[model samples]
Every structure is written in structure tokens, then in C-alpha cells.
Target: MAGGAAHRRPLAGALAALAALSACSLFVGVGALSPRMLLDEPDAVALMLASRLPRTLAVLLAGSGLAIAGLVMQTMARNRFVEPSTAGTMQGAALGILLVTILAPGASILAKAAAATATALATTSLFLAMIHRLPPTQPFLVPLFGLVYGGVIGAGVTYVAWQADLLQLIEIWLNGEFSGVLRGRYELLWLTAACVALTWWVADRLTIMSLGREASVGLGVDYAGMLRVGLVIVSGVSALTVVVVGAIPFVGLVVPALVSRLAGDNLRSTIPLVGLCGAMLVLVCDMAGRLLRYPYEIPVGTVLGVVGALAFLAILHAGPRHG
Candidate 1:
């Protein structure tokens, strides 16, 4: 009972913080939104419904999805640093988007997302294959190789976009801003909500797979099948996020690591907290971006990239002993 109480307190605190930040997100934009206006002004009602609500929802959904993706990657790779960006999934999605823009300029949003998902799956599979070849004693090599792989892919994307004169569109997709997310523009993020639900459903199987292939197979788990499922989930979530809000780096890496620190690695219990913390982090970053320049807005991706980098460094310094 005492241990349970201790666990509940942090979970409760995280949820509370998430709630507060979400509320602030709804009210902190450039628009003049106030309690009084929400009740009295029709334009305010429309604005709140059309822009504020959707932006807030998008942040929450994207944050949760990315964080969960990170957890899934770490589990599959058996490496803490192997999040979407580090694992080349984001670059794969970027490459897919660039390809579609170049090949089918008039492609629908769904088609673009499909292309991105396919590329993300392929890239993630390559990462897994590379990791399999490396000695397990050198865990750091996996992420280092992933970074190089992703960098190469990113460079290719840049070259292609430059040649095609689609650099500006790719820039917007890479920067990951939520300022332009109105209702219709952001509804695709709802797909991430379904992805999160699917993650919850498979949480137990993933936890088993994290014990390594030999151990998982010994336990009668379908190791190969589960790996494919995990990759699909990670690819779908990463691709959808890139499609909807661009790539918000480190949410996946940082949030899951933090949740594991607090709650241990029983993912069934911790995934919810991971999702909540991820949502809170992004909401806080998004709110900070809105307020930083008063009238002008900074992109959430830029803010989180700086903040997440610092946090990532700290996590590295702390080492696994602390975690």
C-alpha cells in the first residue's frame, strides 16, 4: 500500500501538470481569448473552437504519439537512445514526403502519409537489421550508427528538395510549428489517438520482447511477429506525426526515459504516465513558444529541440546507474 501510494503521487502530479499546461495552451495564442470573450463574443467562440481547441488537441496527440513511438523503438532496439529521430524514422518520413511532393504534387494528404509510413517502415527495419549485426555489448553503437544513417538520409532529402525547388515546403515540415493548426488542418492527428490506443493494447507483448529475442521466444512469445508489429506501430505513429505537425524531436526519447525513471519499466502501468508527461512537455514548450515573442511565434519543434537536447545530455551524463 505504501509503495502504491508513492507511485500514485507522481502519476497524479504529472496528470495535474498536464491539465494545467493544456489549459494554458488553449488561452496563450496571439488571439484575444479571455473568459469573458468566450462567453460573450460569437467570434471568440468560433476562434476558440476552430483554432485554440484544435491546436491544443494536436499538441497533446502528437506529444503522446511521439513519446510512445520512442518507447516502442527503445524496446525493439534494446537501446534507450533509439527514438524516431535517432533511428532514421523521421528522416524516412521526410524522404517520403519529399518524394511524393516531387512525384505527385497533387497527392492527397492520406497518400502522402501512406508514402511516409512505407518509408519509415523500411528505414526502421534497416536500423533493426544493423543493430542485430552489432554486438550487444556496444549499445552506444546502435544510436551512433542510427544518427549517421539518419543524417545521410536527411542530406539526401535536402538535396532532392533543393533540386525540385520544394525546399520551402520541406522547411515547414521539418520545423514543426503548431501556430497554423486550425480545426480542419489538424484533424489528422486524431489518427495518433488510435495509435496510442493500439500501443496500450500491445504493451504487454512489447514488454516481453524487450527481454531480447532468445528470452522472448523461450517464453513462447512470437518474437518475429511482435517485432514486425512494433515496427509497424512505430512507423505509423512517426509518419502520422510528421504528416500532421512535422517532427518534434526528443519527445519520444526524453519522455519515455523519464517515465521509466519514475515508474520503472512495467510499460502497462507506465505508458499512460509517459503519454501524460509527453503531452505536458509539448504543451509547455508550445505555450512558451507562443509567449516568447508576444506577437510572433516560435516553432514548438525548435524550442523542444533545444530543451530536449539539454535533457538528453543530462540523461547521458547521469548514465544507466541513475535511471
Candidate 2:
């Protein structure tokens, strides 16, 4: 009982911090708007509705969704370092987006998203098939293979973009930013948010699946179907995020690894904390990007890349120690 209370306390604290940061996020952009202006200035309210609110919501949804998706990927692969960005999922989505942009420039956002999601799903499935063939004794090989696989896919995408002269546009998808998120721009992330909830509902089966495929089948958890579900969630979330805000790497890799240290592998309770930390990490980075440059803005993806890269190395150094 006391242990449960202790756990709840940190979650509650994280929730409070996220709420506070979200409020500050609204006031950071170049426009002169604030909570004070909303009472009397119609423009402030319109600006709030049109831009600030949507951006904040996008950050929350994308961050939380990615974190949950990462957790699901880790649970399925039984590898801490494997996630969308490392597993070719994001690269495949980038490929789909590039193809649509080149072949059907007139495609609607939904069509483009569909293509990206399809390719991302395919890539994730292929990665899983490859992982299945590898011996489980060397778990580290999964991540090493994923990194090489994703790099190859990413290189191909870059080459295509260069040949097509879409390299500049593709950069936006490579490094995520929330500046373009307005009222109508980011609603698709809601679907991924719903996916996160579904993950929570099936969290127990996922935890059991983490033990291994044989163990999951022995426990009557329908391992194949659940693996597909997790793949879809991971792919959908990764594709939508790239389509909307671009690829923000290492959220999946770092957040879950850190969360595991604090909470162990019982995803039912830890998922919420993971989601909260993800949201806070992105929000804080976004805010820093705004303040560090004053009038100009750095992409949140750049800030996170710097931070996530350092964290990634730290995780690499410490992983064997933990194991």
C-alpha cells in the first residue's frame, strides 16, 4: 500500500509539471498574447484558438503517443533500444511521403498519411521477421541490426529526395517541429492518442508478451495478433508524427529506458509516467528553443536531437551495467 502511494506521488507531480509547462508554452511564440490579453483582446483569443492551443495539444499528443508506442515496441521486441526511428519505420514513412509528393502532388493530407502508415507498417513487419530469425541469446544484436537497417532505408529516402529536388521539403519531415501546428493541421494525432489508450487496456497482455513468444503463447495471450496490434500502433504513431511534425528521434529509445529503471516492466502503471515524461521532455525542449533565440526559433527536433543523442550514448554506456 505504501509503495503504491509512493508511485502515485511521482506521477501526480509529473502531471502538475506538465500542466504548468503547457501554460507557459502558450506565451512563448513571437505573437504578443497572454492570459491577460484574452479577457479584452479578441485577437489574442483568436490567436490562442488558431495557433497556441493547437500547438500545445499537438505536442502533448505526439509526445505521449510516441512514448507509448516506444514502450509497446520495446515490449514486443524485448529490446530497449528498438523503436520506430531505429527500426526503419520512420524512414519508410518518409519514403512513402516522398513518393506521394513526387507522383501525386495533389494528394490530400489523408492520402499521404495513408501511404506513409502503410509503408511504415510494412517496414516494421519486416524488421520483426528479421528479429524472429535471430537467436535470442544475443539481445543486443536486435538494436544493432535495426540501426543499420534504418540507416540504409533513410539513406535511400535521402537519395530519392535529392534526385527529385524534394530534399528541402524532406528535411522538414526528418527534423520534427511543432511551429506549423494550427487548428486544422494536427487532428490526425488524435487517432494515435486513442491508440495509446487501447495500449493501456491491453497492457497486461503486452507485459506477458515481453517474456517471449513461447511464454506468451503458453499463457494464452494470442501472441501473433497482439504483435500485429503493437506493430500497427507503432507504425501509425510514427508515420502520423512524421507527416505532421516530422521525425523526432530518441523519444522512444530514451524515455522508456529511463521509465523502466524507475518503474520496472509492469507497463500498466509505468505507461502513464512514460507518457508524462515524454510530454514534458518535448515541451521543455520546445520552450527552450523559443527562449534561447528570442525572436527566432530553433526546431524542437534539433534541441531534442542534441539532448537525445547524449542520452542515447549514456544509455549505451549504462545498459550492460543494468542488465
Candidate 3:
């Protein structure tokens, strides 16, 4: 009982801080709508509800989904340095998108999203299998290999785009952006919320799998089934995020990391907290982008890329004790 109380206190504090962050996210933007307008003007209300609201929601979903994806990847791979982006998953999807543009210029958005996601999942699975065969003495080798693989894919995409005279278009797809997100186009991001819920429902199995294949099998858990399901979830979240918001990089790596530090890594215990942390991190970055530019807009992806990189390096320097 006392232990529960001790845990609850810090947890409550973190939740409160997170809620405050969410509220701050609401007032962020360069538009004419002020806090007073949020309450006073109909036009302001419409703009707030239509543009900023959806954008905020999109940021939240992308951040939380990416963060959770990172958590799952780290736990499953038993490597703190590995993330979906670093593991060549997102890069593969980006390469897939470039291919689609070359081969099927008229492909529907749905078709492109599906193809990119399928390719990402397949590549991730292949990378993992290859990692399993590598010498165990070099534990970090696989993630490095994944990075090299992603770089190669990214280079290929860039080269193709240059040759095809679509470099500018490809550049837009390469970096993530949230400035253009509005009510209709941004709702697709809500799919990430659904993904988060699914993760919660399967939290127990994931927890079991995190202990390792031998331990999971000893406990009668179907390791292969659980793994395949997790991979699908990762691919869907990564691809959908890219499709909607253009590929915000480090949300996945940083959010889960911060949550794991504060709340511990138990699936059920840390899920919502991790999600909230992700939302807050992205929200803060998005707001910074909006406020710093005034009339002009900076992409949330760019801000996150800079911020997430710093945060990730900090985590790496902090070492694995917290994780």
C-alpha cells in the first residue's frame, strides 16, 4: 500500500505537468487568434477548431505513436540505440514512396501508403533476421548496419529524384511538415491513436516478449506471433505518420526514453505516460516553430529534428542506467 502511494505521487505530478503542457499547446501559433479570441470571436473559434486543433492533434498522435514505436523496438531488439528510423524502416518507406512516384505517378494516396508500409515491414523483418545471425560480441552492430542501410536508401531516393527532375518534390516528402495540416487532411493522424490503443490491449504479450524468446516460450507465449503483430504495428504507425506528417524523426526515440526514465518500462504502467510525454514534446516543438517565425511557418518536422537530435544525444550520454 505504501509503495503504491509513493508511486502514485510522482505519477500524479508527471500527469499534471503533462496536462499543463497540453494546455500550452492550444495557445501556440502565429495566427491572429489570441487566447481572448479563443473565447470571444466566432471566426477565431472556427480557425482555432479547424486549423490549430487538428494540427495539435496531429502532433500529439505522431509524437505518441513514434515514441511508443521506439519503446517497442528497443525492448524487442534489446538495444537501446535502435529506433524505427535508425533501423531502416522509415527510410525503406521513403524509398518505397520514391519508387511509387517513379512507377505510378497517379497512384492513389491509399495505395502509396499501403505499398510504403508493406515495404517497411519487410525490410525491418529482414534486418532483424540478419542481425540474429551476426556475432553476438558486437551488439550495437545491427543498429549501425540499419543506419547504413537507411542512408543508402535515402541516397538512392535522392539520386532518383534528382535524375527525374523531382528533387524539390522529394525534398518536401523527405522532411516532415505540419504547417499545411488542416481539418480534412490531418484527420488521418488519428489513426495513430487507434494504434496506441491496440498497443495497450496487447501490452501483456509485449511485456512477455521483452523478456526474450526463451523466457517467453518457457511461459507459453507465442513469441513469433507476438513479434509479427508488433512489427505490423510499428510499420503501420511509421508509414501512416509519414503519409500524414512527412516523417517527424525522433519522437519515437525520445518520448519512450523519457517515460521509461520517469515511470519504468512496464507496458501497462508506462504506456499512457509515454504517450503523453510524446505529445508534450511534439507540442512544445510545434509551438516553437510557430512562434519563432511569426507570419512565416517552420515545419514541425524540422524543429523536432533539431530538438529530438539533442534530446537523443543527451539520452545516449546519460547512458543505459535509466533505460
How well does each candidate superpose onto the true structure, as a TM-score?
A: 0.96, 0.96, 0.91
Stronger candidate by TM-score (1 vs 2): 1
Regions of model 1 farther than 4 Å from truth = 1-5
Cα misplacement distance, residue 55 of candidate 3 (Å): 0.5
**Model 2's lDDT to the true fold?**
0.89
Off by over 4 Å in 3: 1-7, 321-323
In order, how many clashes per candidate? 0, 0, 2
lDDT against the true structure, per candidate, is: 0.87, 0.89, 0.78
**Tens digits of per-residue lDDT for model 3, 218-313:** 999999998888888788888887777787788888877777777666787777777777777777888788778776778888898899899888
> Model 1 Cα displacement at 289 (Å)?
0.7
lDDT of 1: 0.87
Q: How should the candidates be ordered by TM-score, best one leading?
A: 1, 2, 3
Q: After aligning candidate 3 to the native by TM-score, how far in Å is the CA of 10 from where it should be?
A: 4.3
Clashes counted in candidate 1 amount to 0
Worst 10 residues of 3 by lDDT: 1-10
Q: Pick the winner on lDDT between candidates 1 and 2.
A: 2
Better of 1 and 3 by TM-score: 1
